[model samples]
Target: MIPLTEEQQMLQAMVRRMAREKLKPRAAEIDNTGEFPWDIVELFRENGLFGIHFPEEYGGSGGGVVDLCLAVEEVAQGCSDAAVILAGQALGSKLILLSGSEEQKRKYLPRIASGEFIPAFALTEPGAGSDNVSMQSRAVRDGDYYVINGRKIFITHADVADIFTLFAKTDPEKKARGISAFIINKGTPGLGIGKIEKKMAHKGNHACEVILEDVRVPRENLVGAEGEGFMEAMKILTTSRPVTAARAVGLAQVALDEAVAYAKTRVQFGQPIAKFQGIQFMLADMAIKVEAARQLVYNAAFLADRDYKSKEAQRASSMAKCFATDTAMQVTCDAVQVFGGYGYMREYPVERLMREAKVTQIVEGTNQVQRVVIARALLED
Candidate 1:
């Protein structure tokens, strides 16, 4: 295992304890009710988890991507739903950290770090999931403001977010290069929340549609220059992939742990099922996958913290995201197999782990997309 610094180790232990004592107990109820866990968010705020990756100048802890991944992985081990909330904050603010003007950063980052303002990343649209350039959202500059008109789908925390880092096409003819990023406050005149999706997993952290019809944002809210949003978005994804991979690692680890505990206690043929060779092999394989994924995730995170824009970091991030999430899906399924009929029941946490693992493969750019990125990076001159 890669060694963590004393501070990182302490942060991990504290988050693990909090997850175990607070989040895990409520994970089931959150899943059942599909309600956002406001109390858990409060816990994260009090623990300073939200600011782990932000700079100390912005009211953060002056940590790096590795610190964020450590916290995310630990929280996910107990409750993947709650972990999503913690990670989503980082996702929403990342673009600003990468490209926001000093004035913008000074104004917004501290509020996010303090958890006084919840933020959402608005990029995906009904028609533009992986092919972001195809988004129909348009932003027209009018006087001192940009009038944004578009519908963003699959937006995390949209309904509850106080602000959004939104992207729209300033010049549709240029395709990807035409997109511009903006920050829109929640109560802006034409900004409205649309459908809230009932997801198969991570139900406690909501994803919904954000409708913008002539939402006027000031010129000062524009992030970076015009036509830089796509590049900025890609950069943030490269940096965030490792964190996503860490989440997959945590979910798989918990699933493996649950399976092992069950096998040792579950009786069959007048002996514990763990004594069987078949179960033993499955456990071994799960452990192997989880460890390998963890190493890859840490490697990517280290590279990202060093320099996110480097080609090496980009390739490693994609590779880690793809492999770790795939491992999570496979390991969780095997865990269910170990549980047999009990795994299929809602009472078993393995069932939920299995469900949650599937989303890790799908989100943060699907595994298929990650593979494309890896291949492209390999061929780059």
Candidate 2:
């Protein structure tokens, strides 16, 4: 348990109240209808939830990564999908803050902080996922602009995002070094939104393919140096991983809470199931794992707030993301077991949580990638 500042604590309390009073009541409807949570987004904006981590000069609250994670965890407790709306905003804006020039930041970061802009990150393509080196997207320098041509898949918030932080290959023969990042507005010429994927979990969370057919972007929109996109992405992931871990922890805690609450009232053999040692043991294990994961996530976020580019921070983020999300999958499954048959039913929140837990392992660079990162860091040291 890391001690939060008074301001952070107050922010957490406000988010928790919002989650319980607002998001929890709508979680089921959002899942069932598969509709974007625009109302929730409006709520967050009204409450000054966007861009909380950027500098105050940029219209942000002068907070840090830890502040972002604290808000995410509380929001996730009530609606896991809704939490993504907040975390995803950070994911979309991270590159700009880390690698964008002063002119770029001054132009965009303030809009982000003011909730006047909704951003999406476009990186993954049909041919490139974990192996970003295999990217096929091309960006040819034209007169005063770069013409980009490629298709980006699994782009979160793409359909509705006001702007995109996109990546393309500026010098194909250079492979990874060839990659370049850009900031392209949504309505840019030759930019098109493709099929919207109906995900297994996080149902209403919007993600789709973004097609760039000779999209022309101003040279000024290039983020950082032309050949530094890959490194910039790595830096973004270093901080973003812990945010995902915090989401995993929050979801796991909700599962544990639901399981414990159900166990106490569920009657079996003329007694409450919580009275049985088997159920008690499961509850205890779930509680332990969730707490442990939470601590790791908090520690990772703290390290990120202190230093975003250090090797230590990268390693911690990878470890925390890997362990916490894995814990989420295990704890959510056990939560279902605690509910017995009812757990499998849609009427119970544990079943939904179980499904949600599975995706955390797959997203944010996958647990497998995290282990590779952790191993390489360990071996290098």
Candidate 3:
């Protein structure tokens, strides 16, 4: 096991307690009903869980990326969707912390920190998924504002975000280099929410389409320079990937816990299934994978917290995200097997966990893309 500081240990204990007491009971209900858990979000806000990773000068808790990962892991142990609400808060504000001008930080970070606002990252469009360069969103500069026109699909929290860190091409001739980031407020003219996706898992969270039509944004709202959005987005992803891995680790650990508990009480062959060597072996492997994935998640968070720029850090983050999420999928499926017929039923939490695990492999860039990133980084080294 990786050693944690006293503060981290304390944070973990507090969050774990909160997860068990507050989040665990609601997780299955949230999944079954497919309702947004506003009360849970309010609880996070009331407890100062929103902006743990931002600087204190901007109304944050003054913690780093690792702090966010730690908190996320604990919350995810109960509800992956609840954990995502916290993750989305970080995702929205990270670009501001990384590359926003001082004015932007002063204007926006405080609201996010105070949980008075929810932010969304708007980059993916109808034509762009992994190939961000294929994005068709356009932003033409006027005298004092840029008129943005296009739509962003699969945007997290699109229906309720108070602000958006949006990407659009200001100069399309330069391809990726021409992309610029902007802070678009929620009520801007011609900006509206479109379809809400009915997803298979993480039902408490919604990903939707953000439609922007001749949306006028002041030039002062731009984040970084006019041509740095691509690099800024890359930086955000590298750090976010570790947190994503932390989510997977927490979910995997929960699956293992459920499997072990079921195995001990479940009768098979006239005795407890856990007494059998085969069942014991499966549980053992699940435990091993969970621990290994946890270690990698923490290691990646460490590199990210220190702002390490080495190729090793890049590779570690991708490795953790890929390995942990893949483990989540495998471990959850194995957990379902341990429950046998009961596992396949919706009454049991394992079935819900299994469905939730599949999304981790696809989100924060697919596991396939993560491997490509690791390989490219290795080649660079």
Candidate 4:
């Protein structure tokens, strides 16, 4: 078990209680109705979950990535959808924290930290998924302003976000090197919302298309310099992967808990199914996987908070994300198996868990992409 500081332990206890008492009861309704949980958002805001990882100077609690991961993991135990809402805040504001000008940070980070404004990261496009360099979005410099034109698909919180950390190519010929990141406000001219995707999981956290047609943005809103957006993105993603891994760990842990509870009471052939060696072995394996993944995730978060730019931190983040998410998929699937036919039904929670676990492997970066990153990091001098 990873040791936690007194403050960390307190934070964990508080968030765990909130998740069990508040979020879990509403999780099913949010999933079934596909409604954004504004009440939950308010709860997070009121409890300071939104600002847990930001600096105190920016209206936050001055915690680190580890704190953020702990909150995400605990919340995910009750509702993965609500956990996304918490993590999404960090994901959207990270670029500004990392690369925004002092003024930009002062203007935006406070609102984000206070949970008064929502921010969305706009990068994925119709043609750009894994190979984001192939993105067709373009921004042209126009005398103190840049006119951005593009469509970003699968953007989380796009419908309600007030600020966007958007990426586009300033020099299409330069490909990846040409990409630039900008801060675009929601009401900018020609900024529009397209289709809201009906997803298989994370129903309460909406991902939609952001349509930018000649959206004019001030030059001061540029994050970092032109051609540095992709590099900035890669850096922030490395820092954020550990949090994503934590989400997977939470989901896997909860699935195991549900399975174990069901197994002890489930009778078969004159004995509890948990008494059967088959079920016993499965439960043991699930527990082992959850513990292993949790350790890996915590280690990565520790490394991130220490020195995110280090190669060791980068590699560990990828490893944690890849391993924990795969563990989630496997553990959740086994949990469903433990329930047998009942697990397959919507009436049971394992089915929902299984669905939630699949996306963790795909998001942040696919498991295949993580392997590539790990291999490249190893090959580097």
Candidate 2's clash total is 0
Could you estimate the TM-score for every candidate?
0.99, 0.99, 0.98, 0.99
Candidate-wise lDDT, in order: 0.93, 0.91, 0.89, 0.93
Query: lDDT by residue for model 3 over 1-381, one digit each (tens)?
Result: 457878778888899999999999999889888888999989998888886888899998888878888999999998998998999888888898888999999999999998999999998888898888878999999999999999999898888799999999998999989999999999999999999999989987889999999999999998999988877787778789888888999999999999999999999789999999998999999999999999998898888877745567778889999999999999999999999999999988999899998988987789999999988877876
Better-scoring candidate (lDDT), 1 or 3 = 1
What TM-score would candidate 2 get against the native?
0.99
Q: Write the per-residue lDDT of candidate 4 for residues 70-184, one digit (tens) a residue.
A: 9999999999999999889999999999888899999999999989999999999999999999999999999999999999999999998999999999999999889999999
Q: Judged by lDDT relative to the true structure, which candidate is superior, 3 or 4? A: 4
Deviating ranges (above 4 Å) for candidate 4: none
Count steric clashes of candidate 1: 0
lDDT of 1 by residue, 1-381 (tens): 568899999999999999899988998899899999999889999998899999999999988889999999999998998889888999999999889999999999999998989999999999999888899999999999999999999999999999999999999998889999999999999999999998898898889999999999999999999999888889888789999899999999999999999999999999999999999999999999999999999999999999999999999999999999999999999999999999999999999999999988888899999999988877875
Where is the poorest 10-residue window by lDDT in model 3? Answer: 305-314
Highest lDDT among the candidates is held by which one? 4
User: Which candidate, 1 or 2, would have the higher lDDT against the true structure?
Assistant: 1
Best-first order by lDDT: 4, 1, 2, 3
